[model samples]
Target: MTISLHRSATVLFQGDSITDVGRLVEPDSPLGNGYVRMAAERVLTALPDAGITFVNRGVAGDGVSDLRARWREDALDIQPDVVSVLIGVNDTWRRYCSGVVTSVRAYENDYRTMLAQVRDELDAQLILIEPFLVPVQDEQWAWREDLDPRIQVVRRLAEEFDAELLAADGLLNQAARAVGGAELITGDGVHPTPLGHTVLAEAWTELAGL
Candidate 1:
């Protein structure tokens, strides 16, 4: 769907490390070096005079709860014309790596709360990106039990909120299978490689009609 933005529109991207992509590490470049940047570049190139501003507030190692905790300051306060979220994978990651499980119910609850806040408080268009995993290792496949439910939650929430939904998981997986293996898609099972980032940016730009 093509989302209409007002003049001088500000687009904000929020999520975990994949979205972060070393934003804090390279403070001079707040947009980081990921799909967020690529998407912004594509949009600006298409509409050079549109006066669109892109902001990335994705924090590495963040979960849904972390987004909830900082939503007011990081998202709402920005008053963006569009808000894009790419989260949930870290929630699954933490469960396996640190035994800190965010149940499906809790994940939905937190996600809904954040979306509700955005709906009530802002006039921004919402883009809810599905948290994806490209399994390069044997054990990463086991994470599907946790991540699949969260992806469904995102889809449901997007429908509920009249938001744009990006089925990134399936799309990226298809890309992985289409040409190269999972390793070419992502170095690990979580973060995207440069090619993977391009795939995401292309999909996002097309979906948003940027």
Candidate 2:
């Protein structure tokens, strides 16, 4: 299957650190170092004549609110045909480590609002990637109670927005269990290793049919 949004279109990626793996911060270099870069590379290689432009506007530690704040400047201004987003890990992580409690209700509300803007205002194809954690440490396992609900919210939002859903969480967990465990994928419980990112990119590609 082909991802038929718009022909020869520009695709914009938005989210937190996982997405913002050090994008050049210059127009000359837009693809970051994580799944975004890998996905772009695959698209270029597979569809060399498609002439799609890929851009990453993910900030290292952004939450749903942060993405909302920069939506116009980073995303809307670009007027992309497809907008892919992976967020909510920081929202859950902050509650665990920084006493910043982003309740499930609040997370869902903010995330829905952001997606609505993309759907109504920009008229773009939306791809919502589920936030993931591999449980490398004890504390990471506890994060499930908080993170799982947010992941559910993303699924609901995807349905509401008629968007594509990329189940990165399940894919990574299965990959980890198939190999060794969470440690091999994510050294900590959050950030992914190079191999982990590659897994994510491949999963996204397969799910998006790109």
Candidate 3:
């Protein structure tokens, strides 16, 4: 699917570590080194006079609840003309690693709450990126049981909101397939490397029609 952008759009990127990529909370290149930065750079570089302002509000290790908590400040307050969300992996990861389970139902509820608020409060177009896994470890494979349901919920939400859906999970899987599941997609099956981020950038820019 093609993503359309307004002439002078204030684009907001929100989510977890994948989007964060060690950005300074202060200023000066807050988009970090992940897909957000890569995509933003490509867009700005391609059209220096597009008047597109990009903001990255992705904090490391954030979940749906975290997003809901900060929605007013990071999202709505930004008055974005377009909002892109790339969250939910942490919610699934914590279940196995930290024993902190966020049931699919709870995950969907929290996600729905945030999206509903954004819809009610802003005229921003929405782009929802799927939370994905690559399974570097055998245990990571099991995460599918929990994560799949959440992915389905996100799909439903995108349909309900008529939002643009960036199918990260499947896209990453397809990439992994070409490389035969090498650590190429994600060094640790979660956080992406620079090369992986490039892969994401290509997908995102194409999604944005940039």
Regions of candidate 1 where Cα sits further than 4 Å from its true position? none
Compared with the true structure, the alpha-carbon lDDT of candidate 1 equals 0.92
- Stretches off by above 4 angstroms in model 3 are 25-27
CA lDDT, every model vs. true structure: 0.92, 0.86, 0.87
Query: Poorest 10 consecutive residues of model 1 by lDDT?
Result: 1-10
Q: How well is each residue in 1-210 modelled by candidate 1, as lDDT tens digits?
A: 667755699999999989999898998889999999999899889888879899999999999999899999999999988999999999999999999999999999999999988889996799999999989999999999999999999999999999899999999999999977988888897899999999999988987776
TM-score of 1: 0.98
Q: Would you estimate the TM-scores of all the predictions?
A: 0.98, 0.94, 0.95
Error of 1 at 182 (Å): 0.3
Q: RMSD of each candidate?
A: 0.9, 1.7, 1.5
Rank by TM-score, highest first.
1, 3, 2
Candidate 2 local distance difference test against the native: 0.86
Greater-TM-score candidate between 1 and 2: 1
Between prediction 2 and prediction 3, the one with superior lDDT is: 3
lDDT of 3: 0.87
Alpha-carbon shift of residue 193 in model 3 (angstroms): 1.5
